[model samples]
Target: MKDRVLDLVFLVGVLFKGLDGLAELVTGVLLLFVTPAKLHQAAGAATAGERAEDPHDLIANLIVHGVAHLQHGSIVFAALYLLVHGVVKLAIVIALLIGSRGIYPWAMGALGAFLIFQVYELVTNPSIAVAILTVFDAIIIWLTWREWRRGRELRTTWRGTVAWVFRRRVAT
Candidate 1:
């Protein structure tokens, strides 16, 4: 039952991570084609008459604010960043699903580093998305560590049992 719950959590985590990757990839590709003015206009249309405190309003305002600050170099940098970040996350999701024993440690390390960065960004910008992602990453890290340790214990126990059985046969 515990294992089932852990597996479910891991799958849910992977689904969210995959969605995050797709969002980055799609947004990056769109930014490559869409002008800032067009984005601003779309944002305006989407948020038309929305209450100031509405989530959509907040997102639309943020979109417009971000577009307002964009420079040509910054746009290119952001596009590349989104693409690379999305690809890396997608790869991690694949590795996790495949149950690669060696990849868990690397994933934990990478996620831990990202969690630190997320904390810094949250402190500076205070995005709910970042906070939620940070929490997810922390949970995933803990799960990965537990899985790795469980594997190690299983291997050790198997080896010890095998050795004990062989020794008993030799004594007989």
Candidate 2:
């Protein structure tokens, strides 16, 4: 029963990661074609009503302020970052979904590294989205570790059972 709940949570987290990866990939491709000026204009247009209603709207202001200072180099860097992040995430999701034991450590390591990076980002930028992502990554990391330990235990038990059976057969 406990394992069932963990499994459900893990499955939900993996699906979220897959969806986030696909969105990142699409956004990366879009970034390659869109100019900073265009992004700024779009942000302004989208937030026009919100800004009018409440000029200090946090989300709307953040979006507008962020794009207002955008640069060409920033766009390139963002695109590359998103593309790489998306690919890694999707690969991890695929392996885990397929029940690949070898990938358990690899996925945990990769996500641990990313979690560290996200922490740094959160400290430096202090954005709500980054904070949320950092927390989510932490949760995923915990789940992965738990699952890995569970898998290792199962493998160990299976091996012990097999060896015991082999010894009994030989004695008989």
Candidate 3:
């Protein structure tokens, strides 16, 4: 039962990683086609109704505020960042799902790096999304470490169990 629960958690974590990758990929693609002026206009248009309904709407205000700070080159940099992260994360997810023993470490390293970034974002920006992402990434990192350790133990035990069978048994 414990194994099953752990497996489920791993599955959820992997699925979340895939989702995150897809989101980044899509956002990056959109960013590639957007200019700061156009993005700001769109943000204003999108949030106008919400802002009108509630002038203090946190989400609407945040979107407007964030868009206001976008510079000409910011979109390009962000697009590149998201695109690279998306591709790497998707590759890691695919490798992990294919059951590559060697990918576990790589996956952990990539995820740990992202988690650190997310933690920094959470601290500096303090958004709900960043906070949730930070927590989930932390959980996934722990689960990944557990998974890697478990794999090593299984391999070790199997090797130990099979070693005696390979040796010649003396006739008694």
Candidate 4:
């Protein structure tokens, strides 16, 4: 029962992560298209600041903005890869835990390392960190879905066992 509840929670977390990924992807794509001057104008409109009206300055601004977006996009892609990998690892760990007699210490260690990697990324490259986080989110979602399915199967099997036991008691 505890496992079932945990699986459900994981699934919800995964779904949220996927949504965050989609949102980042959209934002990155938009950044690629939007001009820096236009972005500045939008930003300035929201606050009192010296408006950049020079064309050259606008070009420089656009270049910097574009580069930032490119970097962000690359980071996001890397994060997506990591997330998928993490999800796969989690699923494998769960399988090993259930199908085998004992817990796999190595899998737990790997999870710990993965978590550390996430923390390191948070501290070092926070600007594009969302990209990595989103990727992990997608992986978590996938893992959650897998766990939910496995939980359903286990539940069904348990129900069958209970029914069989009830029948045997009645017969006795």
- Candidate closer to the true structure by lDDT (higher is better), 2 or 4: 2
Clash pairs, model 4 backbone = 14-141
How many residue pairs clash in model 2?
0
Model 4 weakest 10-residue run by lDDT = 99-108
Pick by TM-score: which candidate is best?
2
Q: For residues 10-91, what per-residue lDDT tens digits would candidate 4 score against the true structure?
A: 5445345345445545555555555555555555453323224553565455544554444445545655655555454545
In model 3, where do residues sit more than 4 Å from their true spots?
A: 123-125, 152-172
Where does candidate 2 stray beyond 4 Å?
A: 152-172
Q: How far is candidate 2 from the true structure (C-alpha RMSD, Å)?
A: 9.6
The TM-score values for the models, in the order shown, are 0.71, 0.81, 0.79, 0.36
lDDT of each: 0.72, 0.82, 0.80, 0.50
Q: Pick the candidate with the highest lDDT.
A: 2
* TM-score, cand. 3: 0.79
Model 3: per-residue Cα lDDT over 92-145, one tens digit each: 888776667788888889989998888888878788878887888888888778
- Provide the clash count, candidate 1: 0
- Writing each residue's lDDT as its tens digit, candidate 1 over 12-119 gives 676787788889888788778776677667776766656355756666677667777777677777788788777777777677666566776877787788789889
The lDDT, on a scale of 0 to 1, for candidate 2 is 0.82
